[model samples]
Target: MGVTGIGGFFFRARDPEALRAWYAEHLGVGSVPYGMWETQAGPCVFSPFPATSDYFAADRPWMLNLRVDDLDDLCARLEEAGIAATRDPEWDMPGVGRFARIHDPEGNPIELWQPEQPA
Candidate 1:
């Protein structure tokens, strides 16, 4: 019970430069070494995908979920920045949250979620 939360996430990017820039530009995540993001108060979903499950794209093993305050605004910003934000109503839960997916410049899927209530 000592672990409080996730400390960091690391993944491979085909073009690290462009991928990093994409996140930084649109999502405001600076390079990880000393990056700082203005995060909002919300529940961060922490779950592990089963080995045989095909929930996420077959190519990548993990998806990054970032908590946001305004899903609509974020989606619009991403779209305006030329980032395709895919909204799947099938993934919505009545009281859990809403989700939208987007791939980084390197094709790494990023899931953005806004919880039903602030955490």
Candidate 2:
């Protein structure tokens, strides 16, 4: 049988507890380590970028792209929390989605995407 969806995304955090708290408070992600997070059914993209790809930081090996329901509201909340969520109009596509970029406290790149609604 073919592989199912992504089961987990594990990464090393200098301060795992603090990072977990930050994600829980800001992004509503599960705070418990190794806990299951129920996600809505939607499209997920798994693409490997070139080693020299400038789309994300060169320092980091991987970037996390999360599907979001409301990009504007989430960006506003992030802004209020003093986290800079930068957006460029050029990143929006007719059928793909709108995107914004933000970094975690430890400098990991995260991309927030709001997919275009189906016609």
Give TM per candidate: 0.83, 0.95
Give the top-scoring candidate (TM-score): 2
Question: For candidate 2, which ten residues in a row score worst on lDDT?
Answer: 28-37
Q: Candidate 1 lDDT, tens digit per residue, 1-119?
A: 89766566667767667777677878888665444555544466778988777877987888888877789999999999888899999987768888899988767788888778745
> Which residue segments of model 1 deviate by more than 4 Å?
31-33, 38-41
- Whose lDDT is greatest here? 2
User: What lDDT is obtained when candidate 1 is compared to the true structure?
Assistant: 0.79
lDDT (CA) per prediction: 0.79, 0.91
Give me the runs in candidate 2 sitting further than 4 Å from their true place. 33-35
TM-score of 1: 0.83
For candidate 1, give the lDDT of residue 18: 73
Tens digits of lDDT, candidate 2, 3-110: 779888999999988888888788887766644578898999999999999999898999999999999999999999999999999999989999999998999999
